[model samples]
Structures are given as structure tokens and as C-alpha cells.
Target: MKILHASAEYFPYIKMGGLADMLASLTKEQSKTEEVYVALPLIGKLGKSPHWTGKEFPALLPQDDKIDSLVVSVLKASRFLEAEESGLKLYFFQSDLFQTLDSIYGHKEEHFRFAMFSYACYALSQILKVDVFHAHDWHTALSLALQKDSALPIPTVFTIHNLAYQGDHPFWMTGFLKEEPFRLITSPFDHDGKCNYMKAGILSANQITTVSPGYREETLSEPNGFGLSYCLRQRTLDYSGILNGIDTEEWNPKIDKRIFQTYSFLDWKEGKLKNKRELFQEMGRPSLPLDAPLVGLIGRLTYQKGFPTFLQTFTERRHLPHRYVVLGSGDPEMEDAFFQLSETLPEVFYFYKGYNESLAHKIEAASDFFLMPSLFEPCGLNQMYSHTYGSIPIVSRVGGLRDTVEESNLLKFKTGIVFEPNDTSSLGYALERAKDLFQSQEREIVVKNIMNLDWSWKKRKLEYDLVYTKAIELKI
Candidate 1:
């Protein structure tokens, strides 16, 4: 089947969060079975790369008479040998819309920028004559809107990576939509008297999917749904969940050259120790006993990640004997708080101000446990990476964290631990248990169990292939 996947950003080109990782891995995996192509904005920051096949397609602009229409150039990129070997086509749209160094969202003309992208996606699909258009998040949500108005006979599948980030803007922002081409399209994009781009996609698409089974359930409720619960419930028959998978080849600690040491599931202890020592030296922590438990966290320093709960657990429950190394940047207040905690407890806590991909790998390999106490995680990739590196994950019991990390992985012979979301006391208790396990000889067994968990894309890819087949069958 010929599939066109559309997103705002993609890996090796641009990455903001797990969405990029998911798209890159899914495309590479699905390419083995079907013809997969991608459409993304050609942001100037990605600069120029050899992977893109620079070509242009037609785009219509209603207002400007002299240049009422222009050619939207595409930069086809597929750097991964596996994608090329499997015959996947990765296409990027090079337009002035993504040229600015400004943030992806919260721009003055974001409504028009994303709308243009969505319209361009529909145009590209028609030009390429694709069988199905698979779009991610609200950035490409308007593509379904374009398809609804057009006479195009293509089917669409929309994936909601995060329901919280619905593209809701004032309707008046889209002044150009008053023209002939956009007049026939119903304004279902307006939800609660506002332009809800995500709602429009969810309402219009033939199929809708989220990242994890737990998240699928959460999004159907009041708290986690972000006001789209009722809408999602109405489309229950059309919606489903598929857990996100990791690219084991890229994340495997055994072969990863980014970390200080390399080790597999069988011989993880030695490499883990090497990593821990390196982490201590790099973070400027004094040399401590190898038996000391090291808990690592890598994420945005935001309230959504349960940073406050983490701080409370670490500060109030001083009885627990453990060290924490945090790497992230967000919300200046939270960053400063973490920095202060590191200063107050120099021996037990370490903080890295910003994100560094290689350092993330090092932290995963070096730490005895990975902590992701998110209030609601759509589907965390770091926890999966932690399991692969033999670093047991201690996460809040919510969303994908609940689905991926099980009790067996957290028990005496288990790989990881889970606590109730936003419960500081529970988090502290879980940490104590993990620390106690480490002090005992049971830590090795736990690490071994975690290392044995399968996080490969092979199985998830099969599921995606099935989804693609079902999408095509429904289209037929």
C-alpha cells in the first residue's frame, strides 16, 4: 500500500519530543511491508542536507493576484539505510512558513502557517497519487478539512500524539478561508465557538489512534481528555490504541557508542558501573561507593512531569539513601528549584541545565534506576530506553508508564517500580524500596529482568502494517 505520513517534525531533521521518535521508527518499520512516504515542514534550522531530493509542487494562494499561486518545493530525505533498503520515501516540504527560528507553536500566524502546511499535504498527496494520508497531531489536522471540501477520493487516518495540545485558535485568524476554494468546507474546525483544528481532524478522519492503550482510555475521560473526551467517546468505534515502540538498534546499550561503556542484557553490571563512575565524574559528584543507588531522570522540567512531586519526595523523605542526576530544561522556576536542591544536597543530587542526546544515553546506561514520575505520560520513550539499558524505571502509574512498566518489573526480582501519580509519599516509598533492593543483592536480578524486556520495533511494526492494511481495505 502507498501511504503518506504527515507531521510537523521528524527525526534526524528536527526533534522536539517523542513524536519525532515514534514517526521515524514507525516509518522505518512499516517500510519493510508497505510503501511509506513522509511529509514535513522544511524548517530553515534543519539547514541543507544531501538526503533531500529537492523538487517543487503547485500551491494555490487566494489573495495575491500576481503570484496567486506558487510552487511548494519538497526536499525528500531518507538518511537511514534501512528506509532506502525497504523502499520508503521520506519527503519534506520546503516553504517560507517554516523558515523562522521561532517556536513551532504559539506564533502570531500559527493558524495560517499550519493551515498552509495541511493544505500543502493534501496537494502533495493528490500530486503523488497516494492511497492513504496518515497525519500526526493538530499540525496536520486541517488536511482532513481540505479533503472534506475537495473532490479528492483519498482516505485519511489521524494519530493524536497528545490530546492536550489541540490547535485551538480564534476563527477570525483565517481570513483567507472566506474565498471560493475554502467556502464549501464546513467550519467544523470551530469547537465551542473557537477553531479547534484537532477536533476537526478527529471528527473527519476515517480512523483515529493514540500512542498507548492506557492513554486511549484516559483520553476518553474528563481529566486526561483535555475537553475532547465526549468527542472521542462518540467516535469510539473508529478509535484504537497502539503502544509506541523503540528503535532497539539505535537505543541498545550494548552497541551504543555514545555511552561510556557497552554491555548487553547478560553482562550489564560491569558496563553499568563504568557508566555510573563516568556520570559522577562528569556531573562533578564526589566519588562514592559503587553500591549507592543512582536514580536518573531526563525530561522537561515542567509540572506535567511531576517535578514538584519528585522534589517533595527527595526533600521530605531524607531517610531514603539514593542519588539523583537530572537532565532537562524548562520552566525557569522549576529549573532553578532543581539547581537549588542540587546545591543544598551536593552529595545526593545533580542537575544538568539543558538537553544533550549523548548525555541522555550516558545517564540511562550509568544509572541504576530511571525515574519518570509523570502526572500523565502519553507514551514515554526514555522508560523503554532505560529498560533496554538495564536501568530499572521507577515511574508514576499512568498512561504508557502503567502499560509498559509492570509490577513484575518492579518487584524483588523485577526490573522497575511504579508509584501513584502525583503522590509524593508513594513516590518516596517506591524510591526507598528501590534503594533497599539495590543495597541488597537483589538489584542484579532486577536489572537482569529489566534488561530482558523486549522493546524492539519488529512487533509494533507488524501492528502498524495491519493498521495500514485495514485503512486501505476501508478505503476500498
Candidate 2:
């Protein structure tokens, strides 16, 4: 099948979150058997590469109440890093509007920017005769709506990474679609008389998907859906969930060169010890005891990640026996709070302001336990990464966290610790449990079991292939 995946962010070129990582891995997996292409907006300053090629086309766009157009260029390039090895073709929509943008998102005219990019992606899909149009999140949900507005019998699939971030704008912004034949389509949902990009995708697409089955169930119910439960309920038959996969080749412990030491499950214990000591030394700390639990946290320091609950746990339960290492940058107040806490509790706490790919690998390799106490997780990649790197995840029971990490029960094989979100006591208990597990023999078994489990795109991509075929069968 000729599949065209449309998303706002793609790894290597631009990445704001796991959406980029998942799309990159998914498309690469799909391209192994089928013809796969990716469409992404050329955001920020992208350097010209020797492997890249380009073509220009005029695209009509809605500017306010006026009919305006612009000439956009679609640059075709092989997947970055892999560079044609994966057989995935990436088409970057280049426009004057995107050229000056300093970042991939957070612009005042975000709706207008993505609308133009979406139309350009739709045009590219048509030119390439794509069999299916797959749009990711609200960033490119507009592409699915554009496909519907054209009445172009193209099968479309929309994947919701996070329902919380629907691109909603005032009804007046509908002026972008004011002209005849370009008017907005009526969605199954009405967002307070506003234009909601996510709702349009859910309404128009042939199939809709969330990152995990637990998350899909959450979306079809109240609160978790963030006001779109009714709309999702309307299309329950066509809605489904597929767990996102990690890049096994990039995240594997044995072959990874970024860490201080590398080992497979055979020598994971020794490898982890070496990595741990080196990591501590590098971070300006003495080597902690071998049995001491070194907990690692990586990602955006935001409320959604349960930073508030985590902060409360740290402040109230200072007697807990564990060392904490965090690496991320987000939400200024949370960052400041974490920094201050680390300063006050220097011996047991350490926080890094920004992300470093190599440091992330080292932390994962060295830490005895990885922490992700998320308020909600659509589909978390860190838990999977932690599993692969021999780090047991201590994640909350939400979304993909619950789906991916099985609780450590003595009767059955387990992967990691699971606790309730938003409860300081629950998190404190889970951390204590992790500390206990770290010193027990079961820790070895759990780490080995999780490491052996498959979270790669190899098997999961087949589920997507089924979804695409189903979409084509029920083509709208």
C-alpha cells in the first residue's frame, strides 16, 4: 500500500514529543513491507542536506476573509540519520510562513500555519496517489478534514496522541474557511461555537485511534476525553487503539554506544553497576551503594507529568530511601521548584535543566528504577525504554503506563511498579516498594522479563497495517 503519514513533527527534522519518535519508528517499520511516505511541515531553520531534493507548487490558502494563495515547495528527502536505509520518503512542506517561525509550535497564528501545511500535505498525497492518509494529533488533523472537504474518496486514519491539546480557535477564525467551496465541515462535535481541529479529524476520518487501548477507553468516557467523549462515542465502531513502539535499534542496551557500559540481559547486573557508578561520578556525586535505588526521571517538567504530585511526595516524604535524578525542561515554576528542592536535598536529589540524548541513555542504563508518575499518558515511550535498558519503571496506573507496565505481584511475572496518580501517599508507597524491590532477588527476574518482552515496531506495526486495510474497506 502507498501510505502517506501526515504529522506536525517528525524525528530528526523536528520533534516536540513522543509523536515524532513514534511516527518515525512506525513509518520505518511500515516501509519494510509497504511503500510509506511522511509529510511534515518544514519548521524553524532546517539546513540543506546533500541527500535532499525538492519541487515547487502553488497552493491556495485561506487568509482571514480574503482568498489568498502562496507558492509552497515540497522537499523530498530520505529519513534523516538512516538516510534512505529505511526506504521511507519524507516530504517537507516549505512555505514563507514556516521559514521565519523560530519553533515548531506555540505561534499566535498556529491554526493558520497548520491549515496551510495540511492543505499542502493533502495536495502531495493526491499527487503521489497515496492509498491511505494518516494524520497524527491536532497538529495535522486539519489534513483529514481537508480530505473530507474535497470529497476525495481517500481513506483517512487519524491518531490522537493526546486529546487534551485540541487546536481550538474562536469561531471568527473560521474566516480561514469563509470562502465558498472551502467552508469548514460540520464536525460531530461543537466546541463552544469554535473551530476544533481534533473534532473534525474524529468526525471525517474513516478510522480513529488513540495510542493505547486504556487511553481509547478513557477518551470514550467523560473527563478524560476533555469534552470530546460524545464525538468519540458517535464513532465507537471505527475507533481503536494501537500501542506505540520504540526504535529497538536505537534504544537497545547491548549495542548502544552512548552509555558508559553496554550489556545484554546476560550481564545486565554488572553492566548496570558500572553505568551507575560512572553516571554518579559524572554528575559530581560519590558512587552510591550497589543496593541503593537510584530513581531517574526524564521528560518535560510539567503538571501533566504529575510533577505536582511528585513534588508533594518529595516535600512531605523526605525520609524515603532513594536517590533521585531528573533530566528535563518545562513549566518554569515546576523547574524552579524542582531545582530548589534539589538544592535543599542535595544528597538524595539532583535535577538537570535540559535534555541530553547521551545523558538520557546513561541515566536509563544506570538507574535501578525509572519514574513516570503521569496524570495521564496517551502512550509513553519512556516506560518501554526503561524496560529495554534494564530499568524497572515505577509509573502511575494511567493510559499506556497501565497498559505497558504490569504490577509486581509475587504470584506472577511482572515488569514494574504501578501506583495511582495524584495521590502523594500512593507514589510514596510505590517508591518504597521500588526501593524494596531493588534489594530483592525478584528485581533481577523482573528486569529480565521486561527486557525480553517485545515493545518494538516489529509486531505492533502489523496492527496498523490491519487498521489501514480496514480504513480502505470503509473508505469515506
Candidate 3:
């Protein structure tokens, strides 16, 4: 089978979140069994890459009169930039709008940008004659919407990495759409009658999928659905949740070059200690006690991640016997709060205000406990990375965090610490539990069990294969 994955970002080229990582791993694994292709918008960085074959496929797009005042009957011909990575064929659509983009997202014309890109992807899919078209997140959701009523019978799958962002655009953007689809879009695109790309994909695609089973359940209700619960219920029979898997090759502790030392379950204790010491030195901190648990977190420091709640917990429990380290930047208020806390309590807290790929790997390997007190998680990869590195994950009992981490309460299946979301007291109690576990002999057992667990895409890709096959069957 030939499958085409369309998204706004791809790893090693452009990345803003887990969507890139998931696509990179999923396509690489799928390529081993079937032909695979990935389509992305040609951002400034990707266009400048040496491997970029300026090979172009020129196609005309209908223009929105409100947005495209400079253009005439049809917009200027957009070029599809062709390239190849590993065994996958890559197609990057570039237009005047994309020529100046230095980043993958955060543009004022986000809706217009992705609408053109989605059209380019659909045009390329027909040209390539791909059997399955998989669209990721709101960025590529419009592609599925475009293909919903096309004469070409290609099967389409829409994967929702997060439903919170729905690409809500003004209805005037309908000028970009061909008359048939605009007429066919009778489904609910909620929120003050705006055209919602995420809802469009959910209502139009042959199949709808989220990252985890627990997240699927959460999104079917009022709170987690983010106001699309009724629309999701309309397609409940075709919706599914496949838990995401990580790329083991890039994340394996036994051979990772990013960490200070490489080790497996056999010698993890010594390896982690060395990594922890080196990390402390790198951060310019004094040596910590050997038995003290080193807690680490890496990702956007936002309300969704529950960092403010964590700050409250730490403020109230400053004497807790644990050291904390965080590497990420977001929400200016949260960043400043964490920075101030680190300054006020340097002995217990350390904050590195930005993301570093190498430092993230080191943190996963060095820390005795990985902390993710997320109020809601679609499918967190860092926790899985922590499990692979033998770092116990202390997570909230919500979404994928609940699904992936086995609570220490279950002695036989103990892997990490679990607590309630947004509850500072619960987080404090969980941190105390982690400290006790670090001092106990069972720490070794928990680490050993977590390392032995399988969270690789090799097994998880089979589930996707089934979803693709079912999509094709339904299309026929």
C-alpha cells in the first residue's frame, strides 16, 4: 500500500510539538512494510536545505477575494518542492505566503497558509495515486475536508493530536473552497458559526483517530472535548484512539550519544549517577546527596502542563527532600515564575529557560524521577522516553499519563508515581512518595520493570495498518 502523510511540520526539518516526532517515527516504521510519503509546507528552513531538490510542480489555486486582493481570477501558480529523506518521498508546497516564514507556525495568516497547503497536498496525492491519505492535526485537517466529496475515491484518515486547537477561521475564507465542498459542508463547524478545520475533518473523513484510548474517552465528553463533544458523538462509531509509541532507536539509553554515559538495565544505577553528576556540573550547581531524587521536566511550561500548580506545590513544600530541574519555555508569566522560584530557592530548584534537544536526552537519562503534572495530555512522549531511560515518571492520572504510567500503589506493577491534576497537595504527596521510593530498595525493581517495558513503534504501527485497511474497506 502507498500511504501519504500530510502535516504542517516534519522532524529534522520543522517541528513545533510532538506531532513532528510522531510522524517521523510512524512513517519510518511504516516504510519498512509499505511505500510511504510525507507532505509538508516548504518553510524557509526546509527550502534552504542542501538536499532540497528545487523540483517544482506548479498548480493554480482559487483565491479568497477578501484575503487575496493582489491576485486576479486565480491565484499565482504555487510550486511543490520535491525532496527525499531516508526511504520516504517528501513533497513541500511553497507559495508567496510561505517564502518569508522562518518558523513552522505562528503566522497571522495561519488559516490561509494551511488552506493552500492542504489543497497542494490533495493535488499531489491525486498525482501520486496514493491509496491512503493521513492528515495530522488541524493544519492538515482541511486536506481531508477537501477530499471528502471528491470524485477520486482515496481513503482518508484524520488524526487529532490535540482537539483544543481547531483552526477556526472566518467564513469568508470559503472563497478558497470549490463550490461543491462548500455546498456539501452541512455539518456543524461550531463556535459562533465559524469554519472550524478540526471539526470539518472529523465530520468528513472516513476515519477519525486520537493519540490515546484515554484521550478519546476524555474528548467524547463536555470538558475535554473543548466544545466539540456533540460533533464527535455524531461520528463516534468511526472514531478510535491508538496510543502513540516512541522511536526506540533515537531514544535508547544503551546507545544514546547525547547523554554523559550509556547503559542498560544491567548498569543503569551507575550510569544515571554519572549523568546526574555531569548534568549538575553543567548547570553550575553544587553536588547533591547520592540518595536524593533528581526530578526533571521538559516541554512547554504552560497552564495545560500544570506548572503554575507545581510552583504552588513547591512554594508550600520548600523543605521537601528533592531537587528539581526544568528545560522548556512558554507562557511568559510561567517562565518568570519558575525563574523567580529558581532564584529564591536555588538549592532546591533549577530552571533552564529554553529547549535543548541534547539536554532533554541528558535529563531523561540523568534524573531519578521524570515529572509531568499535566492537567491534560494527548499522548506524552517524554514519559515514554523516561520509562525507556529507567527514569520513573511522576504524572497526573489523566489522558495518556494515566494510561502509560503504572502507579506505585500497585506493588506488583509499580513503575512511577501518579497524582491528581491541579492539586498542589496531591503533587506534594507524590513528590514525598518519590523521595521514599528513591531511598527504598524497590527503586531498582521499578526502574528495571520500566526499562523492560516496550513502547516502540514497531508493535504500535500494526494498529495503524489495521486502521488504514479498515478505511480502504469502508471507502469501497
Best by lDDT: 3
- Which tens-of-lDDT digit does each residue in 50-139 have in candidate 2? 145444433433231243322222212111211232587777666656867756877878877777677667766766778999999887
**What's the count of clashing pairs in each model shown?**
3, 0, 0
Error of 1 at 382 (Å): 1.2
The order of the candidates by TM-score, greatest first, is: 3, 2, 1
lDDT against the true structure, each candidate:
0.78, 0.81, 0.83
Clashing pairs for predicted structure model 3, backbone only:
none
- Candidate 3's displacement at residue 218, Å, is 0.6
Please, what are the lDDT tens digits per residue for candidate 3 over residues 411-451?
68787889999999999999889878888998898899999
Question: In model 1, what lDDT does residue 228 have?
Answer: 89
Model 3 TM-score is 0.93
Relative to the true structure, candidate 1 reaches a TM of: 0.91
Model 3: how far residue 158 lies from native, Å = 0.2
Candidate 2 positional error at 28, Å: 1.0
List TM-score per model, in order. 0.91, 0.92, 0.93
Error of 1 at 133 (Å): 0.9
